[model samples]
Target: METDRKYLFTTRIPVRWGDMDFYGHVNNTVYFRFFEQARVEWIEGEGFRVGPDVPTGAVIINADCTFLLPVNYPATVLVKMYAGQPGRSSVMTWYELYVEGDERLYATGSSKVVWMDTRTGKSVPLPDTLRARFD
Candidate 1:
């Protein structure tokens, strides 16, 4: 997979006091939300629909993040995400978080989601509409 694909996304996020846990850093759970928001924003920017296309859908099967550094409050953060290698029914995505002012890397992660037929609850192939949007 091309690691450079992440350069395709641009998402700015404000650091909220509530997002920090007892560790004085953004909680681990919050990273998932940030990644999701970034992906949605990127899709919207590309003019792609996130909902079921012709009554089909996708679900995340696996996701993981590796924290390289802590992100504290009072600083803005930026998250960048991009599609990775496409599979028969799934696509991997890469995500990176960095401090806005200094570009300090805080974390990196990836997620794999599988397209599925909502009615039957079985994996399905990526539709042309969806694939083209990512491509």
Candidate 2:
């Protein structure tokens, strides 16, 4: 990842024993949960509430993760998330996971979320208020 790019949100998550696989390292699938936690926090921090009644928000359309190092239990992971360039109806969200108190990266991930009308399940343009938060 580029050192120059600034992250918009960051949070610490404790690794649970159940998060590990038979190999004793965090499972590959668990990384997406970490990304989801950070993304939800970032969206709420930007003043968007995700609920049944909420009319505007985003739905993840695509997601990916690249593991650089194995993560074990008894560790607190720091996750940093940033909003990339926004398109007409979607925005890219990038994530980086690291061992707490250490700078080295453990994994990197990204997701593309499409803005939509929650009630109708139809795509919508990114709201200016939400887009401005990325700036």
Candidate 3:
């Protein structure tokens, strides 16, 4: 059993020169991508893997975000990820973004991903190994 009551995953992503829009600060779209990297790495860190080999692969069915602060170039922001809920074949990941050296959260959001059979392209049950990691 993955007894990690609070699974915290963090990554320091260097704000790319191109990530900023004309208005400056990392574009709103980039934050979602940052959140995705955190979530994917979180799952990959576990022994469980996500790929075409699995009968079911995950797909983001829903996503939402709130920008509390602006992130600019030459900065490394921390993206935090954690499992929100795990059901039969779906899992929701909660995330928070914090600028380095700051204790305040810059953004918070959650995404719902559902497992689907790659071959059949239909929703399926969550693999036991992956499900076990959830609280």
Candidate 4:
């Protein structure tokens, strides 16, 4: 479903031959990887580091994907990210994937990310600076 989620960012990733499985198309599991790459790029683009280095970080609580079409190798995938309204400590993110140069949607997905204190592992209010990015 192409929901009207607010667009936030877009990135392009070239499909590798290794992404394909025995069925001769991209494996089902790799779609999450594609969604992840886009999410990471968007996070870093906003000038935040993901791993243990940060005092607070984002953790995805859940993720889901609906595959609509198969993607083959030798293509560059365009992953578009959108955001739902930001909450006190969490937000929902959506993704749309398509082969670059083509408008046809191949997959769509979403994940809920919670901002938490890295050390304590408890949810914390989102940073004001980062919160504006969602607007």
Candidate 5:
């Protein structure tokens, strides 16, 4: 968990059986999918457009996750998003994952989301609306 993080958004994703690896746990890579799903849902819920056609939007520069416990099937993952202080063009976003209705954290992760001009594929200043949320 990150201290001094601004609560941003959250979403729940059901874990599909196919998400499991041979070891019978959710694939390590699936954690990132959960993170991305939460991030996109929040961003869109905030009324920011995302996609190649958008003139300006978000891009992930990097992401990482720490698996604290195994996630099994027939579970819904609750992803709660938090944000670090905003910079000129980017913010550090954190996520805490738990099985819905469970107190134990399954994982924690973070990603750097940069505001960008999609056409140019270059970073842009954070949108005022986005920066306001971090404030």
Candidate 6:
């Protein structure tokens, strides 16, 4: 658990049998899905929706994850998400995965999402409302 940084949003996700690989550990790709879910939940929780009609939303430009420990099924994981460095048109979203109720870190991930205008399909600065939520 990274104590120095405060996470604005947290979610509990149950590991499904299908998330495991032949080695009985969660597949590496599943971590990305976990990160995506956490990001979407955080966005919605902040009173923002990502859709065609929304004037401003984000499009993920890059994503990366580092696996620290193997996770098995029948376990719930805690995903903590927060904003990292914010740029004029993009922001880095950070994520930490932990074993539920434990301080041990299972993985860490990040994604760079660029704000865009849905109608014009062009990059745009982060809306003041969204930026305030991150702050």
Best by TM-score: 5
lDDT tens digits, residue span 1-114, model 5: 568889988898999999999999999999999999999999998899777788999999999999999999989999999999999999999999999978998899999999
Q: Tell how far residue 132 is off in model 6, in angstroms.
A: 1.4
**TM-score attained by model 1:** 0.83
lDDT of model number 6: 0.86
- What C-alpha lDDT do the candidate models reach, one value each? 0.80, 0.88, 0.80, 0.91, 0.93, 0.86
**Candidate 4, residues 1-135: lDDT per residue as tens digits?**
335568989999999999999999999899999999999898888888988889998899999999999999989999999998899999899999999988999999999989999999999998888899877
Model 5 has an lDDT value of: 0.93
lDDT (tens digit, per residue) of candidate 3 on 1-135: 123325558888878999999987899999999998887777677655677787657788999999888888878889988775578888777788998888988898878878788899888987787787674
For residues 26-132, write the lDDT of model 6, one tens digit per residue.
99999999999998888888788967888879889899999999989989999989776567888878898998867899999988889899889899998787777
Q: Per-residue CA lDDT of candidate 1, range 76-128, in tens?
A: 88998878657788888888889898767899888887878887889989777
lDDT value, residue 74 of candidate 2: 84
By lDDT, rank the candidates, best first.
5, 4, 2, 6, 3, 1
Candidate 4 accuracy as TM-score: 0.94
TM-score of each prediction: 0.83, 0.91, 0.86, 0.94, 0.96, 0.88
Q: What lDDT score is found at residue 87 in candidate 2?
A: 78
Ranking by TM-score: 5, 4, 2, 6, 3, 1
User: In candidate 1, which residue pairs get closer than 3 Å at backbone N, Cα or C atoms, i.e. clash?
Assistant: none
Give one digit per residue, the lDDT tens place, for model 2 in 12-126.
9999999999999999999999999998887887788977788888899999999999999889999999777777898788899999978899999988889999878999999
Per-model root-mean-square deviation over C-alphas: 2.6, 1.8, 3.6, 1.4, 0.9, 2.4
Model 4 worst lDDT run, 10 consecutive residues: 1-10
